[model samples]
Target chain A: MRQSSSTTDEKEIRETVAIILQNFSPLKENLIPILQSVQSAVGYIPQPAMKQVASFLAVPAGEVFGVATFYNQFRLIPPGKHPVKVCLGTACHVKGGNIILEEWKRRLGIDEGGVTQDREFSLDRVACVGCCALAPVVLVEEEVFGTMSPSAVEGILLRIRIEKERRSGCGGNEE
Target chain B: MKTITLTIDEKTVEATEGEMLLWVALDNDIYIPNLCALKARPLPDANCRLCWVDIEGRSAPVTACNEPVYNGMVVKTGTERVVRLQQTALELILSTHPVDCGRCGKNKRCELQKIARHLRTKLKQKRLRDISKRLPIDSSHSLFSYDPNKCVLCGRCIWVCKEEQKVGTLHFAYRGFAMVVTAFGGAPLGEADCTMCGRCVEVCPVGSLIFKNAEK
Candidate 1:
């Protein structure tokens, strides 16, 4: 059953690539946009997807892979439902950003750049969020939490839990 | 190409007009420490930032790898300021690179060792914190092995693989200090679609990529 499902996924990726490639003229310059469109359609760039991009762009597969890796914007794996980005820029670093990062790691049970087993949260260390005045910033999805401390992180978790309970109309240990 | 004359280290040399100063200096038997500038590359990568030189009219030192030479241009490769900047660049590279010359196959022949000796600086950087990642070594390939921690990210290997060999097996992934040469999706070299041309091994400047036969 798993093997058959994987084959179906492969077929889906190929069809997605074909649809995206129709918008591009197979020029080397269009590779990035093609990859971007592919990612938007499929959530992440799978290994087989890279081969499809290579063949469409008429570039080597390795070159496409190299380009994908060189840029920080690309991700090979699927992002979590909630991305937890901890700012580690120069200003945030001086403001004890690592301590906040550690607190998040402990609370979430995951290290930097890892998604939780449940696929709800993923942690990443960002270079900067461009708001230096709000040093030691943490972005939970689209919302930014600034001037963060360990206690503040706990409060944020509690809020998330409360919000979840309100949405589900129930609260339990499973959450 | 038109021929132009330039003075480097009190020695006059004739070089192609609009040629990069780094190659002209090296071709004329004048040494300027560099790790990223490749003769085969049409444009200089200048990622290493170790080829500092002072031209007569410039206020500060400039990297010789990209600077164009003109007729009668006076260049100084070993000024006090030039050496200091070069030393700082080498130190920054060493801060993230492991310094184990004794255990490395490229020990004596390593460009890092040669640059350090030239600059009279220690391989173990003193100022910067060691932010080196302990990435797993890929010994999967039968002919060569890769230790990402030892890589300097010179782009020579990548350029040689992608352009010269047209293999495109090796590539850089990530950003900031986390950037590293990797196979697609961080696959092991043996498992990747590598042709085993061994050109990447030949272009590696440090102990990052070593031939299996050369291992002790």
Candidate 2:
């Protein structure tokens, strides 16, 4: 069982890297764009993407993987369904956004960049969204909601839950 | 075989195959302001919202970056509404960013500084002091230091780090106010597995990431 699992993991990793290389061939000029696309497609750039990117570009896999793992931007794991980003940009921080973020941490029971236990939410902090007028803003799934609070977050969560239940119930009903 | 004519600032201009409405305006010397766009970079980010233009047929302002040129795409380059939107976007960016221009190395050279000077914004806008989170400046290499406090998070650094150098050492960490670009384990830039290629510092629009030599 252990051998099978290990092989499957390796296979999956290879496949992911293969997909990255296939989509972006001739690895030098398009190296960065290819990596960006891979990360966009799969939350973070996986090891497979690095290996394939390295081999396709004719660079060492270790070199490619080392670069991938070096930067702060690439993520290894699949990002959650909803990427809840809190604005920690300097302006937001000055305006008590940190306190609001703390409230979110307490409510969500996860630190920054942490996925919820159920994996429904992934919380991240952004440098700045450039929306300083809407200081203390939180972007949920790419939609910006300004002047956020813990209570407001709860309301947002409730809406998400209700939407999920509705989706599940409708699916069950159809079944 | 399709030709679309457009009017910019009341002057008639012609458009050819696959031209964006923005290119037409720029070609005609009608400058509609934008922040995230450089003629050098591929296209508009649409995140800055500085180049919102009012097209005749479009109900809402279409970003000049993404909007393709259609036949008779009448674009108003200098309208009060467009100016207001640009000002608002600028103000928002300013509110979160520090106003310590005197001390910043990019004092005269920053694109943001240029915009502020052009807009004649007094720097009187209420800035959020607490929003200025101090990120560990990666001084590992003798070449540069990345101060997260001044970063605008335009994703340009990310673009340069991964895209140009292919050294993925910098990334956006945490979400919201806690968000910053850092190496693994939040290590300083020097300690992180960085090649110190200086590409990320080169492309950053603001003073957040700077080359040590370039520091004023």
Q: Which candidate has the highest lDDT of all?
A: 1
lDDT of 2 by residue, B17-99 (tens): 45766767878887766655544456556677777788887777777866777765678866777777777777777766777
What's the residue-level lDDT of A33 in candidate 1?
93
TM-score of 2: 0.53
CA deviation > 4 Å runs, candidate 1? A70-72, A80-107, A120-175
Residue-wise C-alpha lDDT for candidate 1, range A1-175, written one tens digit per residue: 9899889989998999899899989899998998899888986788899998998787778778877776666767766777889999999999999999999999999988788897778888999999989998999987999999888988987887787767774443332
Quote the lDDT for B142 in model 1: 95
Interface RMSD of 1: 1.8
- CAPRI-style class, candidate 1: medium
For each model in turn, which proportion of the native inter-chain contacts is also found?
Answer: 0.70, 0.00
Candidate 2 per-residue lDDT, tens place, A1-175, comes to 9899868866776676677667665847777777787787667776656666766887545445545655556676666777888898998998878887888788789988788887778888888998999988898888898988767888888887787888884654221
lDDT of 1 at A114: 80
